[model samples]
Target: MMPSDAPPPLPEDLFAAARQARTNAYAPYSRFKVGAAVRTADGRLFAGANMENAAYPQGQCAEANALGAMVSAVGGQRIIEVAVVGGREDDPQDLCTPCGGCRQRLREFGTETLLIHICGPDGRRHTTTLGVLLPLSFGPDNLDIV
Candidate 1:
């Protein structure tokens, strides 16, 4: 088994998985498709596609879906790396970063150093860390619940 703290592997296939998941997005309302794939410290991969709802606020982001999948898995909660791809269906080129809510959600399960790989159909365009995306944020640890 790989070490518990090993750095996440940056494989091109991770981006490929996100891109492929983008094709399955249910974004009929905004026509904006987003896909997200996350790699845990344990070397597991999970992918998710954005789903929209007419109610708008009820819509689920791709990142949330991916994170949900990871959380529902057997073990491991630390996401070492994430790949996200999103854009208008006709032209998928915008450097679609995770929204503020998703960023906070990510921070709940990832360290400040967790890598967020922003991708387009062509491939990765930028890479940022959770600290850079959501600086001085609140998380599970912030809760005082016993």
Candidate 2:
């Protein structure tokens, strides 16, 4: 059972969508599978899983994959919410927050959007606004392209 204050339990379909993506993860090195589901402002949901490579630096984060999918599927629509989950056996509690690069990407789309982090079977969730996650983040405003 999930905690009483766990963001009112995301729609079952939403979770299933993320889980399906998790199954496709290609993590032979770390064996740490991660899945991300991103909801766009247009009501489109894009899901992606981590893809690891032998060259550690070449691997893509789950969040980045999801974000890329969202952009590709919806022509760069603004993102609304992002949920990240991970574990050995589809456990959600073991999920960790997005890395610095992912955070910056979130800021580019929606700095004030909600980030939902699910831990495990109990559905333990941590919610935080993207602005809180990336303070003073650089974005379009920072780039001076004349």
lDDT of 1 by residue, 1-146 (tens): 02235434557878888898899999998888899999888888889999999999999999999988887874447788899988543444568999999999898788788898887777776677888888898877789531
> Any runs in candidate 1 off by more than 4 Å, and if so which?
1-10, 88-93, 143-146
Evaluate all candidate structures by whole-model CA lDDT and list the values in order.
0.83, 0.71
Instruction: Give candidates' CA RMSD values in order.
Output: 5.5, 3.9
Residue 133, candidate 1: how far off, in angstroms? 0.6
| Residue 111 lDDT, candidate 1, scale 0-100 | 78
Q: Model 2 over residues 73-134: C-alpha lDDT tens digits?
A: 76666777777767645544454678888888777777454555554423435666676777
**TM-score (C-alpha, index-matched) for candidate 2:** 0.80
Q: Estimate candidate 1's alpha-carbon lDDT, on a 0 to 1 scale.
A: 0.83
| Maximum-lDDT candidate | 1
TM-score for all predictions? 0.84, 0.80
Identify the leading candidate in terms of TM-score: 1
